[model samples]
Target: MAKIKTIIDGIEVEVERDSWAIDVARELGIDIPTLCYHPALGPYGACRLCVVEVTKSKWTWLATACDLPIREELSIKTNTPEVIRSRKMAMELIMARAPRAESLFPLAEKLGVTKPRFKCRDDIGNCILCGLCVRMCDQIIGVSAINFANRGHKRIVTTPLHKKADKCIGCNVCVEVCPTGHVKTLDDGSFRHMQTWDADLEMLHCLICDKPYIPAKQFKVISDKLEGIELKRICPVCRRKETVDNLRYAVVEKVS
Candidate 1:
């Protein structure tokens, strides 16, 4: 095992190499709050909540601890006044953008950020787009149906071609990973829609089953493909079972 040394909150601590900065900080009784940084999912560093000041030689820069790997002779400052200010600013910005959001409000309050300094934009009402939803879809579920479209301030997540996304696998990983409940699937196996006051839609399909279950709008597309197929009326699994049973009966009649 490689030995690593890092300074956190002005105190030096020795840790194992390949360890994440957040895990090392916790061992030293330092708390770095985070969302979208689940242990199981690893770190996407999208929330920007786990930012830390890292000093190496003459360079001092802000880095996300959740994404940083431990290295020898590294200096990390988790709770410096500057770091606290930056964290508060990030919280304020996220809060202003998603005021009524469930997860972020509690974290903002905990960080002692009560109000935003700048005037809140009317469009900043939902989904800060930290990339948690997109990452979960691409990384965990292996479905790239949802993605960040546009660029910079105008960047927003959407399906392919801004049309109903036929590539989605109907998995709810995006919904589960979304910090705000903006991405959600309905009861039917149709498409997932972003809950906005305006009408913006996204869609997905099942990879294995090939059933048009999710995304109601895309149902027509899938239905058209199944129009001539004998198994069109039922779902994929039921269709396969029916075919197997029919083949068995045909074989038995031939034997008789």
Candidate 2:
């Protein structure tokens, strides 16, 4: 990879070309806040919280640092008044949309937004419409179970027809990736329920402990991917115990 020299907050630093501006800034100890940015997901820039002022010759403008690729002679100002104002505005709007989101409060305070000037209905849940959940299911998990529905004010993440998602494997990737506490899943021994997507999948019991470990559909996905490798239907704890027991037996035999 080629190296490029970029100026961040007036400090010149050499970084790998094609690296994101936000990543480089973070590595340089420059605090750039973000919500819709994740190392795994690779920068969707939906939140607009990581905005930074970019200067190139006479042209100067603000851009989201999450997806801004590092280029030659790129100049970035992370904590300028313009950048701070932009982030605060984005945070304020996000707070209004997700008023009940406990996670946003800390970030909100950090950005100096005590309260949002805009007000939304109380029914607006913690979903910030970041698309992390939708992207995780479709891109990484290879299951297009849930997606954005409707437009503008009526926009929401939901399964098709607001019914049970047939393609969902109950993997809980959506739940894990959700920044807000919007996506939820519940396990009641026999079944794993993805409440957000309206999916209920049968749980696969551990062969050794007889405890429900993983969802059957999720196990099938893993099984299919591994091909000929024989997989035991045991939980992680039992698998570790079995490995230890096998090693102990081998040691005893050798000793005898």
Candidate 3:
């Protein structure tokens, strides 16, 4: 791997080639505010909060630090006036989408965005369109139950036909990956519910104790991956107790 020499916020640093500007900035202790960029997932650059001014050769322009690759000799400014203005605008846009979202409010206060310039449309939750949930579902979980629909401003994340997909296993990967805490997962009775995708899954109970442990869909997916491995559908506590009893019985028989 080649090391690219770069200047970030007036400090000259050597960053690995093909690495994102945000990653390199972190290495030099530079804090670049980002809502969409997650280390577990690829750069989506939807938030536009990590914009930085770059000057290479005759060109000096703004680029998203999350997606921007450090190539060749470059001079990057992380907290320039231009960058701050762009970040403020991005924060305001996110605030307009999710007004009451507490996560958005903190970022708004930091960027000096008191009120959203854009008109309020609907009472959508704190989904900042970071795409972590969508990416985690499709790439990590291998379940494409939800995705972006429509175009431009009208576009929103939804399930197939805006109804819950049968493939949704109630894994809550979306809920965990969501940055703004928009998605909510509730375990009620024999079902696991996800509010964002409008998905409800039947819970699977332990065969021995009849205690609900996991969702039926999640169990099936895990069972499929485990080749030839037997699953008794028993809770961990019951399994341990059963194992101990069987071991004790064997010891008594051997001693006799």
RMSD of each: 8.6, 2.0, 4.4
Better of 1 and 2 by TM-score: 2
TM-score of each: 0.67, 0.92, 0.85
Model 2: per-residue Cα lDDT over 159-221, one tens digit each = 999888999999998888788888999999799988877889999999989999999999999
Error of 2 at 98 (Å): 1.0
Give per-residue lDDT, candidate 1, residue 10: 79
**CA lDDT for candidate 3:** 0.85
The residue-by-residue lDDT of candidate 3 on 1-256, one tens digit each, is 8898999989988888888899999888998988888887787899999999999999999999999988789999988899999999988988888877876777789888999999965656666777888888898888878888887777777788887777798888888777778889898989888866777899998988888878899888878878879777988899999999999999999999
What's the lDDT for all of these models?
A: 0.72, 0.89, 0.85
Q: What's the true lDDT of residue 151 in model 3? A: 79
Q: Best TM-score goes to which candidate?
A: 2
Best by lDDT: 2
- Sorted by TM-score (best first), the order is 2, 3, 1
Q: Which ten residues in a row have the lowest lDDT in candidate 2?
A: 116-125
Number of clashes found in candidate 1: 8
TM-score of 1: 0.67
